[model samples]
Target: MRKQKCGVIIIAAGYSSRMDGFKPLLKFGRQTAVERVVALYQQAGVDQIILVLGHREDQIRPYFDNQPLDVVVNENFAEGMYTSIITGVAHLNDEIEAFFIHPVDIPLVKRETVKELIAAPQQLSKGIIYPSFLGERGHPPLINIKYRSAILDNKQGGGLKRLLALYEADAADLPLIDEAILMDMDTRADYQALLIYDALEAPNLCECYAIWEKHKLPENIRRHCQKVKQTATDLVAQLIDKGETLNRPVLQAAALLHDLVKTEKNHAVKGGEILRDLGYPKVGAIIAVHMDILVDADTAITESEILYLADKLVKNDQLIDLAIRKEMVLNTYHDNPEALKKITRRYHNAEIILQKIQRIIG
Candidate 1:
């Protein structure tokens, strides 16, 4: 079968009103969001790309000078996103058989998703192909050039969704099961969440250990971390045996770095900050909550819970029961009412997590 040529249209012309910062200029891992989006399609072997730059085009255009990409200016960018789409579609390569519309804000989409979206259409040669994760549809939807005329003629102004709705019955919702497909940085909270999510999905476990060593985490703290890692991995193994899915690298890294700054006051929160600064937001998030596991009876066990419970199980590198561990904590903080209250809350959360684990494994 002859290979179909695919092109990509990246819409980076929005005002980014909700993001507070320009979406295209935002950092995703080491590269800017626009750079990451372009690299993703390039890695997938897309024939060509058309980046529609509008908002702050002067600032955005300079970043791509070192890269090979066709950049187009959407003069009507302030009007709405659909105009950017129109500008991109107008610039599509004449020989391109299919193209994907990717918004600059929805960066970090996996390369495999790009491959799958392109491959499915090449085989079928009809209908629109969309990537879905957990029943939610996400960006970079591939469209057959047959709809090019319809898309260009869309002046009704319902945006891309309205254009897509016109062909809903013929669209194929392909499930990619990637959360990055649904993740978009629209607010500070959303950006923070994306950082945490990206770190978990792509954690640098080696750097995590290097940070621990550079800080010269005390030998005792290191031993405790090693023990917690063992305990958490064991629990994770059991959970996996029962068909539970989780990121092993993230779990191990979080367990090892949970006490990174053990000698500091409020080490748990500080440790989280250290990890976040070190570019290990997922590890930091788990470490931040380890000291006070937020137990939600309704929610399933998370890596944070695994790390918290495992830490509770180990007392100075020795596995101990909850009662014994609580006794040790109380003995240390009994004189300080505030410290005692914090310990009480931590244990309360630990108890709930323990119960949930028991139910899962048994």
Candidate 2:
């Protein structure tokens, strides 16, 4: 049988006095810093996330409520980081195949980073996977079930660092452009610095996609389709929630086929041509808007509309829907409020298209 599968224990229990009071309450990009890290593990496709809360559990818990997660309090958190790790891991059941020991304070985690750590079936036994940035190992280390006992035992001192060295984990750290993994909000200065960097760095497409394909995508068109599906499906859900039943066939086909020509001619027209030749003619509109800003010509948010929306919302080639679920897109992209607002409006537009599709569902 397959291994039980891994789970994540993100220790957010610390007071973060280093950053002046509780910094977990701080915003990394769009959501609370903790939410950013939590979304990463969720993207990694872990079984669950247990957010260990302490000093400001009451304040922090409010943001992540109703999300698929569990919250635990570390009464003895001030003693050290090890206690919170112990508490979080100890509460996990046997179903957890491994433990991803992380903290909510580290904000640079990208979904692809987690995928990089989990992609190798090679030596999970020997040690954990660390997504390295320029040769420096980052936070959120992966520990196999075989190492659970050791993690619990070594909680007496030195925290995860000591435990990793003691076990001599077979480590593989890949370079990344998602700097949040390497950056942590330890002080107001650190938080401000990252925010400044976030503003200055205008999202390097090649760099981001290079890491994304290597870590998250399957080296083909699968990931592009995956992102598109998530976007349109999410839009359809919004319609259903608003009392609509979208066209399942069209939605599924268009979301997947929208980006058929992305890596080749890099032309939306070419994408449509490819889809037409492939016998998926209905996706033409979607391919037409693959690189456009908003799929608005008429009132319809075509599959092209949803596809274009999905493509833009992504950062580092990972879905931004789940990330936006807990937080508004406008929060972090404030400087580019127009951009985020356009994205939000596109979502609404997609909802409209889905609503029309649902009307024809009969």
- Residues 137-248 of candidate 1 have per-residue lDDT tens digits of 8887898888899999977778888888889877887766356787788898888877776666334444455566558788899899999999999999998888788778
lDDT of 2 at 184: 80
The parts of candidate 1 lying over 4 Å away from their true place are 122-125, 201-249, 252-362
Query: Which candidate comes out best when scored by lDDT?
Result: 1
RMSD of 2: 15.9
TM-score of 2: 0.55
Tell me the tens digit of each residue's lDDT in model 2 across 183-214.
Answer: 78788888887776554322233333433443
Name the regions of candidate 2 deviating beyond 4 angstroms: 1-4, 122-125, 199-362
Score candidate 2 by lDDT. Answer: 0.65
Deviation (Å) of 46 in candidate 1: 0.3
Task: For candidate 1, give the lDDT of residue 175.
Answer: 68
RMSD of 1: 16.1
